[model samples]
Structure formats: C-alpha cells, structure tokens
Target: MQIQDLPYPDPGVPDVRSGPRFLWWLGRNQLGGQLTSLAWGLLHFMAVSAQPFCVGFAIEAVIDRSGARLALAGGLMALFGAATALGDTFLHRTAVTNWITAAARVQQLLARKASQLGSALSRRVAAGEVVAVSTGDVEKIGWFVEGVSRFSAAALTVVFVCVGLVVYQPALGIVVALGVPVVAFAALPLLPRATRRADVQREKAGRATELASDTVAGLRVLRGIGGEELFLDRYRRASQEVRQAAVSSARMWSLISAIQVLLPGLLLIAVVFYGVHLAREGRISVGELVTVYSSVMVLMYPLRHFEEIAMAYSFSRPSAKRAARVLSLERATDAAGSRAADLPSGDLYDPATGLLAPAARLTAVVCGDPDAAGRLAERLGGHPSEDGPSVLLGGVPLDELPLEGARTAVLVQDKDPVLLSGSLRDLLDVPASGEVGPTEALAAAQCADVLDALVQGSLDAGSPMDAHITERGRSLSGGQRQRLALARSLFTDPEVLVLDEPTSAVDSHTEARIAEGLREIRTGRTTILFTSSPLLLDRADRVVLVHDGVAVAVGVHRELLHTEPRYRAVVTRETEEETARGGVLKELHALGDAERLGDNERQEIEESA
Candidate 1:
C-alpha cells in the first residue's frame, strides 16, 4: 500500500491502541520502501553473522596445517567482508530513507488536520501543544518505526548463529544458547521502570516548551504590564523541573546499560568454560569447539537489540499518544441539512434577542457586557451557534446559507483585526486585486496620511502595491495597523459590513473623517458600527442601545440622547461632564453647529450648481 492509501486516523475519533499499530499503519502506507529496508537489514545482519564462522574456519584450518584448507578459509573471509560492506552501505541508505519518509508522512497528516480544523483548532488545543506535537513528537515516532526492521534482523541473526553452533556441536551449543537468552532477558525486569522515567521526562520537556512559547508570544504585553520578571522566574522554574526529570531518566537508562555490559560478559565466560569441558571430554572436536566459541562471542552482538528495542518503545509510545491526542481534536460542526436561503433586502433579525435592523438604516447595539457584543457580531456573521437565536439576513436564516456565500454578503470586522505583513499600499489592498486599487480604500479608511508617512520613509520606494509587509504587520504602530485593517475591510465592499469598535484606535479627527467617509462609500449598503463614540454615533441614521443583551432603544443618535436617559448617559458622559465644567460644552456645541452649517452650505451649493 502506498502512503496515500494508508488510513489516516480521523480527528474526531478518540481511541488509538498501541505504538506497533501506529508503526504498522506507517509501513502499510509505504509498503515498497519498508520491504526494501527490511531486505537490506536482513542481508546486513547475515553478513555480520558470517564473520564469526569465517574466523572459526581459519583457526581450525591452521590447526589442520593443510594448504587447501587455509586457502579456502581466506577465500571465505574475503567474501564475507565484501558482502558485509555492501550490505551495511545499502542498509544505512534504506534506514535513513525510511526515517525521513515516516517523519514526512506524520507531518503531512498533522498539517492536513490543522487546516481542516481551521480557527477551531486553537480553541480545542493550545498553540504550544500543537507546536510540540508537530516538531518533537513526530521525529520520535519516526525513530521507533525505522528501528523495527533493523531490530528484527538482529534477532534473526542471533537465532541463526545459535542453530549453526548447536548443529556443529550439541554440548557446547546448548551452553552458548542458554547463555544468550540469560544475557538478553537480564535487562527485562528494569525496563518498565526505565520506560516510566522516560515518559515523565518527555512530559516535562513538552511543558517547558509550551511555557517558553507562551512567554515569547506574550513578551511585549508582559513587559508592558511590568510582569516580565514574574514570567521569567516561572519559566526558569519549569526549566529546572525538566532538568530534574532528564537526570532521573538518565539514571534508569544508565543502570540498564551497566547490566547490558556485565550480563553479556558473564554469558561469554560461561560458554567458553563449558566448551573447554566438552573438548576435554572429547564430545566435540577442536574445530567444532572453536566454531562454538566464535558463534557464542558473536551472538552477544544481537542480544544488544533487546535493550535497544525496549528503549525505542519507551520513548515512542508516549510520543505517539501525544500526537494522537492532537490529531483527535474535533473541528466545529455546522447544523445538519441546513441550506443557504435567499436573503431579503430588508431588516435583519435576531430571533434569540428579538432584535431587528430596518432596511438600509443604520442601527446601533449597546450591550452591557463586552463579551455579549462580540457574541452578537459572531451570530450576525453566521458563525455556528447552539444556544442563540438564528440571525436572519433579509428573512433568510444566516446559518442556513453556505459559508462563502454568507461571508460575501455580510462581513464582521472584529475589534482586534489581524494585519498581515506588507507595505501601506499592500496592506490596504484587500483581496489584494490591483483592480479596486488602494487610493480609494485608504481615503475611505482615513489612512491617507499613513500612506504618505510610509512613502516619505522610502518604504514605498518600489511598486507600493507590491511592497513587502512583515508578519502580523509588527512594524506598524497599533493605531496604524488598526486603520490599515479597516481599509482592507472597506476594500471588500460587502453588502452588510459590521464594524466592532472600528474607530477605537484612531484620533477624534480621523475618526470623524472615517465616519463621514463610511456614510458616503456605504450609501445604500447596510452597515453596523458598534461603538459608543459620539462622533460616529451622531452620523448613524439610527442607534439601538443594547442593555443586558437586548436592543432597548432605537432612533437617530440625537433623538436617543433626548428620549432615553440610559442612551444619553452612555453616549454623552464626556459631554455631560464637559457641560458641568462650563466652557468645554460651549466649545463642543460651537463645533457641532459649525459642522451642521458646513453640511447645509454644501447641500445648497450642490442644489444650485
């Protein structure tokens, strides 16, 4: 079976039985490569085992003192050496290829699962956990899978050598065979303890990795709040805990290694002692005794694989479990059998809160809780929800529409919009098409000065539209990134554009210009601006003050200010305080009258001309 044909575990499924099963899954996917690797490993081990027999033959040939026998022994040695060299080379090449392919397959599976989960992945699993599983865990899993073929060949070599020894001389052969098992099985008792220690070590290492990732991502915020040292100290403590776990794991493995050396040496001694007795009793000939001794010595080599396989499994099982957990995260589900319906060109309704936004009219929602506002925006944009009322665009249920279709019709630009790396022009180019152009979008977003500033810095020296942006637009200021995000959203020109605190980052003057530009650019399109800014609110055709998640009052901004005290208190807090201070209110009232007069004059001039 090819890798493509292998059954990838479904992310929604929870049970994953064993490490060998996972390895078998990997092998089935790359059957041809695995077979080639296994064949090479068997040939390599066979070649290695042939060396001892050749040495034994040479020793016996010299004792015989025959020219033909010596020549035959020399010929066998040469053949064995050449074969061993060739087999070793091919074995290494195949083994490394197996390792790389296995790693790549796991990586491909992980990347595909991540994409399938989309935004829901981060919600289900921590970002640091995902990173750990992909990088460190995948490599360990590959290591275990590649070790399987090599270890199997080693065991086969040991078995074949023991049989050859017994066939030549039974008494000596029995001693050698029994000694081999003793050397290999001596390490079994300590393996369970070693494995447990290794598991603890790996878990601690994953935690340290997670803590470091979180620290780096939030470094700026931590420093801003004067908590850098606190987090640093916590990370240092985590690092120490990982160090302790590593030391404990090392101690267990070190004990295993000591036993691996000592038990094998004792077994070789017992075999040689027993073989000497057999020769004294004349039960085995001198040539047979030499072969028995040589085979016993060589059998020690394959016995080492017992320890290696134990260690590989000790590391791999926990790693596979970690990877499996990551792969098992379920993606968010949409309602079954819900189909997209035609949206009405009238009021949008939310059945849960019993709210409606009249056709082509500006509507404001004033929610007491900030989270409630965010949830409302998500519902308005047709994100899947279980508890809330279905949001209806026109009279059509928003959730019933296909994702792409709903997204095109209504866009909810969140408060903290992500700014991808790019120059001012590239940043403003949403959908990044050269057709809509950046000039108009930037002006509408009140980002003309931002573009000019970038141009002045030689940042826009090349084709402005093609200029590179850094990741997350980290190079730009917070307010600049915000406005650029706004510009990109405006470029999309969707039917119902929902802005959540769109003007929060900009100054009052720029905010006012953005409000005026929005009214002009989105003339007939339904737009909802979620903000308590008086400048933006006064420009709205209607305002809905949402208190306790319900739309309580709806009217023009000025009308709501007079009729609803809660609405007036919410929007006019600063103005009311200014009025108490005497001159500030007079200045604001004069500015408001000036803006009204300017609008009247512009209207009159347009009418006359």
Candidate 2:
C-alpha cells in the first residue's frame, strides 16, 4: 500500500496468540508492500556488489594495456553507478512507505479497540502501558517491518559477493567466505543479555510513565493536602530507576556493537594478510589479490545488516507482545444475545432485583448500600454488566438487544460523571437520536449560573457554548462541573434517563430547581434516579426502596417516611431520618451574597452557577 493510502480499509483481525505470531501476521497483511520493498532493496544491493567487481576489472584492463577492455569496464562502472543511485532512492522510499503503512494499520486497530472497550480499557491495561504501546512500541514494530526487506537483500548480496570471489580465486575465496560468517554471527551470544536489559528498561520506564501521569492528574489535590513533595519524591525515585535500567541496557548493546565492529575489522586484516602471502608465492595474480580484498571489504556492509536485523528483532518482539495483548482485549458480551430485536416502548424491569419503573414515569430508587445502588443504575440502563438475569425494556431482555440499540433508548448518568476537556458545545456532543437544544437542556438542568461563571471573564457574549473548559473541568468548581455533566446528559432526551446522585455536589437551592426542572422536562419519559435526598426523592412519581438486593417497598416520599422504617433509614443516612438540607433554599440569596462578599473564595462559589 502507498504511504498516502494509510489506515487500511480493514486492518484484519490480529493473530494475538503470541508476539512472534502477531509479528508474522503484520508481515502477512502487507505482503504487497513488503514484496515491493524487497524487490527494490535487492536491486540496490546488487548494484552495490557489482561496484567492487567493476573496479577490479578496470584495474586488470589497465594492466593489460587494452583500450577496448578499459572502455568496456568504464561503461559497466557508469551503468552500475546509475543503477546504485536509482536503487538506493527507491529502496529508501519503499522502506519508509512500508513503515508508515504498517504503523498506521496498527494504530487504527488500537483506536477501534479503545472505542469498543471505553472505560473498561483502563481496567484491563494501565494508561501508561497503552500510551507506550501506541507510541514507542508501534515505532519499534514498524522499524522491524521496514528493515526486513533491506536485511534480506543485504544477506543475499553477501552470498553473491562470496560466490563471485570464490569463482575468481578459490584459495582466498574459501577463507573469505568462512571468515564472513564468523564476523556476521559473533554478536549472537551477546544478544540474549542485551535483550534482557532492554526488557528491564522498558518495564521501569512504563512504571515511571504511569507514576508521572497519576501525579499530574492529582497535582491540584496533592498541593491542597500539602503532600506534593511526597509524590514528587516518588516520581524522582521512579525516574532514577528508569535511568539506571536504561544505562544498564545501553551497556550491553554497546558491547554487542563493539563486537560487531571488532570482528569485521579483524576479518578484513586476515583477508589482506592471506592475499599478500599468496601473491608472493605466485599462487594468485596481484589483480586477483586486489579483487578478493575489495570483495571482502564490500561484504562488511551486508554483515552489518545482520547485526541490525538482530537488534530489530530483539526490540520488536516484546513490543509485538504488548500490542497483541491490547488487541486481544474483548468486552464482556454475548454474540447471540446481542442479535435479538431492540426493546420497543414500555417499562424497564430488572428480574434479578425485581425493580420496575413504569413507562413515562419518574422512579426514584433508594438502596442503603451505595454499591448496590450503582449496580442497579447499570441494570436500569441495560448495561450488560457482570452476572444476574438481564433487565428487560419494553418486554425484551436488555442484554439481548444490540449495545447501540440499548443505549439509544436508556441514558444513565453516574454520580461522578466526567466532563471531557473541550468547548462547551463539544462537551455536550454525544450519540443520541433525540434532539434537545443546548439552551433548553441547560435550563432544565438549572445551569444558568454555570454559564454566567464561564462567561464572567471572557469577551465572547455571542455564544457561551464556544467558551473553553479545562481538562476534566479542573478550572471549574466541582459543583459547576457536576451541573454541566447533568445538562449534557439531559440534552440527550432519551426514552429513559437514569441518574445516580447526580445533584449531590449542588447546594439545596440549585438541587430544588434541578428537581423541578427535571420533572418538567421528563414529563412523558421514564426517569430512574438512584438517590437518597429527601427533596429529590419527594418529587418522584414513585420511590422504590431496594433493601437486601430486593425491592421492599414502593410509594411516595412522605408516605414511605411515615410507613416504612427501613425505607426511611435507607433514604436518610442519619438514623433520625431528618432532612439535612430542609429550609436550606431560604438562604440561597444569602449564600450567593456571602460568596460574592468573599471574592478570595470565589472558586467554591456556585453549584449551579
């Protein structure tokens, strides 16, 4: 494939059984590119080998005092020079194209896997490992692939050169051929040691990278807690470990490089010494001696390729293993189950927990165990999580429907929703068929204060959606980020909206407004909220109390508070079952005024704003 035609239409499924197997699979996929590179490489090396032969012939012709032979040799030499130039240029072009194409294909496969696995990807592989594989590992893999053709051609060129020397003078040729192999394979013994060092270096580097990533992500929190120096020290130790490992690996490789250079240099001396001794004995012509010497010197170029190929394999082998591991990650799913028809329009019922939210009704679920409440939220949204019978939507098993189909109808917002870094418009972009305008959705989620804060210091008034939010909304207050997540989720306008403690970060005033806004916007759709707040719970059409893995009671907030002790205990974390935020909204204006008065603490100013 051409370099311009990168990202192959289909980067066929990788053979992930082993690193070597995966490497083989990569080579097999780009057979056309590999062959094209190979052909050009062979031509280049052939021309390189012919150069020594031509030089030798020209020397002999000059000695014979034959004008015709000199003219012929000069013409052949010129032709070889032209061939060498063309071969060298095209060989480099093809090798680079192969490298780019191969790297592009692997990148595409990785990107596809990342999208398919989503958040689960981090659970399977470390973030640093993924980064290493995509960057350094991919480059190493491509380096190996790009070098294969050149290595093969160089090896073949060495063989042809040896054969030509042998044909010219048998005695010297035999010694030259035998000594070439010795120089070529001398570094083999050091390779194993070098490869081991490389592996250690890679592992240490990966740990260091992971440490740095984690440290950067939590830098703000660390500084707040006065523990920044602690993490900095840890990172320094990790960095030193990586440095030591790298130095150790470099020492072994340096030894191998020295041997590669030393062996060839000694062999060249032997060829020259043996050729001189034979010339004095009249065993071979002086011209023949020169020819044999030139041939062996040329053979050094190919021998170096042998060393390069060894290093390439040593590095790419482990890289291939890492890449294969990432490609092998498959999401927990059933093919046959996913082929079933989509859920039509009806209630969401979880048979495993016996919790049901009727169609077009706002149902609030309160479970004492937060873990159980989280899992229940997953079920309500038809997330094919681990264990239990499938949750049904519109009389169809949720797990049986395609993932995309299930997500289309049910939208779940976890308590800790992530606000991705981008402009406000980009943050709200998601996969949903229903069209809810940004203004309408923001109004429903009571996010007016957030917009005001975002546009506070900015000049752009024409569109607040264009305003930038820092990575994970680090620049924004926690409460403001939470409101933004809720607004983005509300904009999806799905058939069912499942929210888990979505307004926990907001103040009572904003929470009350959100409660009313949510009820009004979700007037004709199913909304399942897994919360324990009495204010939010009081607004639900029906509150389901999940106790000990079962739905124990279903009723209004006040009715259940008076009727069921367990329901009251679950909803109210306090044993007394008091509304902690009761009458809190009466001080809404006061709270805002206090924050406005203390400009220094503006960072903690708003939950909704």
Per-residue lDDT tens digits of candidate 1, residues 1-609?
A: 234544435322223455556656776665676677778877877877877777777777788887788888889888878887887898778777777777777787787677544444564677777888888888888787777777877887888877877776777777777778777778888988988998898888888888898887666678679999998998899999999999999998999999989987887787778777878987767777767666766666767778888888889888888777776654333422167454445678877666677767666666646667776776676653555656888788766665556666778888767777656555654553243345677788887666655555555466556555566755556677678888887788777878888877789988889888888777777888788888998888888888777778888888876657577666766354433433333344557853555766645543443
lDDT of each: 0.73, 0.82
Top model number, lDDT: 2
lDDT of 2 at 52: 75
TM-score of each candidate?
Answer: 0.75, 0.85
lDDT of 2 by residue, 444-463 (tens): 88888888777774566457
lDDT of 2 at 198: 81
Clashing pairs in 2: 449-609, 450-609
